[model samples]
Target: MDVLSDVMTVLRTGRPFAARFAKSGPWSDHRIGRPNGFGVQLMVRGTAVAVTEGGETYKLGPGDALLVPHGAAHLVADSPDTPPGPRCEPGHAFPGAVLRSDDPEATHVILCLAYELAPNRNHPLIATLPDFVHIPADPGERPGLAGAIAMLDGELASEQRGGDTLVPALLDAVLMYLLRALLGPRTVECRFAGWATALADKAVGPALEAIHAAPARQWTVASLGEVAGLSRSAFAKRFTELVGQPPLAYLTSWRLTMAARLLADTEAPLASIARQVGYGSEFAFAAAFKRDFGTPPGQFRKQAPACDPGAEPFRREAVAV
Candidate 1:
């Protein structure tokens, strides 16, 4: 897997819900924000407005999309001056909802999605992104984005074969498309210190690939610098500037993240998991794990239920379409 793929794999993803609806009258939705959630809004057929609590406003038109990576309190309405409307119900009320307005002369179709984003570690991928990311109406347009959203709609409307398995995968695909749109190739314009700049950078991208590819390897900054074809001092400076962490620091975090994922999903003993993630002894790994995750390896493993990727997705614990 590549760097983003590795991060996505390491992080734990929970149930995701989506709703598409059409409205024609004066309508607005107020959001208090989900500090632990990620949200997406797409203007499917007409116009809408998004405003942050800090008074920043963005006008979204057809084909435009916005991502609230760390759900911030905001308002989405037909116009900026529109008054706040009633708060929405929980995720259970979102799926397959076709809320319409009283009037039928005009129409504004929108797609709203919510995802439970829980990270096992301090992932920079989510940490360093801005408060909101808005992909222009036609900036690097992707035909597959709408298709992915439509697939989610189809699944929600009527569960298809492997719906449990397919829904989460579709959510991941839609999110990736949004992210890729945000981080266009080497010419990306976002002022991101994380994956956007790091992955596109020539010197740091290769080093990141090496660290993610072989976390078990005993890596030093010098070795990583050699891989980047730069001197140790030069590479360290550039890598820190772009990636928000030194090469060795990043390597350690990746190693621990892999260990946490292994504990969550596998039945391997501590010794085996430790060795696979570059720790020498079970005792040493336990100390490091406690320092980082605030819990011992045994307790963490016991508390975390296995979430196998290839297995069935989340059970509808009071969830309904």
Candidate 2:
């Protein structure tokens, strides 16, 4: 029932991101211009009736979810009786979806947030989804989702102490639930591996896990192949097929990602940081880091990449030995 928790899980596993919820007014019918970012809409309290291109109209209710693609224009209204007005183009992706209100009296609450997907790692599962995705309340299949939506509605209405924080988190959780519903059952290509058709293979899972677990682990094609339970050639072939990159290349990029995280979070000695990430010395780590990041770690950190606490990079996930 915690929407933010659910959304964060998807974000942690697939992308790094943040989310915030806001209140919107009941309008007759208003055209929403182009969106600059991607997001989902969760109708917590009041109905959000709308019509999109091709004159398609949707009646969103509580517990329903809509996905706006990178940038799409649409209309939203308090009721179908309202007429849609003009539209504007923001020149950026502002795609979105709809959420319905449960009670006519409850204030219309909309949850919106953006995520940063991995580089060259567009989640195929997400792409299969339509620009606008709607998740209707299913009592039998997804009671938790429904319950979470209701809880968010109540908390937002109450506006008690900590409501702002609690409400946004709940809304995030709902988005994650929706993502799982869309991705968990699907298998898709692994851009980091070329030998496999899908990244969801049990074998591929371990290899990916190991790479994410220790980016600087002196990984060799043979070693990664061992983890994947494939011969070197087979692993190379399959991994290249699934992930679309040589295993070593992916490992290097991950290492740089890890370094970026350390630079932003800790003021640890450069040598210590290098050793921690598997380099024998600071010089070696610096060389590799620069090769990958186009700048030395110290300089990059000085420039100060954005540090979002919620989207910390390369934090190791515990792996079963």
Candidate 3:
């Protein structure tokens, strides 16, 4: 699998949720958040302003999308001066309910998609991202979002055969298209570097894919360089410059992350887990795990929270909206 898809698969902690919301009149709403989740809000119609708790403000219009990878708290309103309205918490919204205002005139529509991610594991690829990724509909930058939104709304309303399975897949596709544009060659966000640049680089991209594909492989700097089709020293320099870590250092960190996920989500024995992450023995793996996680593997598993995807509804969390 590719780097983004692999990380997304390992990070998911619960099922995906999709909903469409309609609001009218002058309004401001602070939406609730999922503890370990990623959220994407696409402006379907009308205009609004987004104010993050960090004081970052965004003006949004039709076809624009905001991606909250770590569930940052934010408020959306008809205008910045609009009085902050009631908090938009869960259950306050029904499948197709209209969030009305003082006067039911002028409608603003938005499509919301959320993905529950694991709290225990943190991938550097995701860690390097900013709090929000805004893919504005800068003319040709993002196309066909309206069509995707219509399909999503229809799939949910119809609930025909296989809708349950199809809805999630559609949700994933919608997000993928938005993100694919984010990683496009023409993405000109000057502030985005590190992992984003490395992911798009021809040399570094292949090396990352190799590491994720086979974490247990006995990889040396020279071997990884060969995989990247670059000389050893050149690859080493470029990888560190773009990725912000030496190749082996990144490998060790990723190995520990994958090990932690296995510890929390699976019941495999310690020895088996050790070998899977490239440790020659259980004792060595335990030491590395403890160093990174501040707890031994056995204890971490014992203290692991209920991470089952069907465990329960999302707990309330906010960043500052």
Candidate 4:
């Protein structure tokens, strides 16, 4: 998989999130889509039938996580053995409804929620993983996941906090935990290994940290090599092998990424934004921004929609650059 060069951080618009419970009696079928945005669904308890984007079907169980990456449509049901019957009418007080099941006597509750994922280009993790990520239960580490389920159950079962305020928060936390279990080790190692991660090399931590800490600073092969404690020539060779680009080239690209974020979010003056991002003047910043993004900063922001207040800007600095 090319050892993956980026990560994805979802941006939220400060919109309140919600979750609901569906009562299923023997026969129940439902469809889910990304009407609001991307989200993760944790099957806290019981087994459900899942049909993914490509029409592949699988039985999802407790502790399993369904990560809908690109807002593709999916179907989750109590049974795949039979077609669906009458759906519970809308405005039924809950997010889901009950249908007749094969058992005719067995009853189950399916928990669901709609959430927003922050957007960022620097991280490519979201596109790398499967549309649905299923996490297996760890008998020893059940407390955390189980507690998340409990919170969801309570939020849906009771009318506390004026609505289901806690379910989304709980689900988001649960997804983070699941991700930690799946990618935690790699992320930790990558941090110590440094920008070589982005460059696909090793022993580049100091350089990565320095670049991230001060994207606007003027940097060169000699200065970065000094930070890496290597001679300029040796550093240049090793850096190219890992980062896939010359030092000055990488620095320029990084600076442009920062400028993009500032333009997209803040209403800062052009000169000020340029200065903040290390450009010597407004003209220099605009030239670079135009070259990188295909338009000037002012024009880019004008064409773009108002960003989510809660969303972190699209700058590389906001992510692990």
Each model's TM-score, in the order given? 0.85, 0.64, 0.82, 0.63
Instruction: Tell me the whole-model lDDT of each prediction, alpha carbons only.
Output: 0.74, 0.55, 0.73, 0.54
Model 2: lDDT of residue 202 = 64
Q: Estimate the overall C-alpha local distance difference test score of candidate 1.
A: 0.74
Residue range 133-212, candidate 2, lDDT tens digits: 66665657877777776676565433356643554466556656665554443255222223223335666657877776
CA error at residue 38 for candidate 2, angstroms = 4.4
Instruction: Give lDDT tens digits, candidate 1, residues 151-239.
Output: 66555445446866776787678878777777766735555667568887888889898998888888899999998889999999998
The digit string of per-residue lDDT tens for model 4 on 298-318 reads: 888776433332342111111
C-alpha root-mean-square deviation, each candidate: 3.9, 9.2, 5.0, 9.0
Report the poorest 10 consecutive residues by lDDT, candidate 1. Answer: 95-104
Top candidate (TM-score): 1
lDDT string, candidate 3, 1-321, tens digits: 777776776677545656555667587888665556677887877988888887799888888888888777788888899988777643323321212212124477666677766677666666777888888875454555556666775664333566556666677778777767676653254246787778778898889889989999989999999999999999999999988999999999888877877887889999999999999999999999999889999998888653344344332221222
lDDT for position 147 in model 4? 69
Clashes of 1: 0
Candidate 4: stretches off by over 4 Å? 1-17, 25-37, 82-122, 142-149, 156-159, 162-172, 187-213, 219-261, 306-321
How much is 112 displaced in model 3, in angstroms? Answer: 2.4
Worst lDDT 10-window in candidate 3: 95-104
Model 2 residue 104 lDDT score: 38
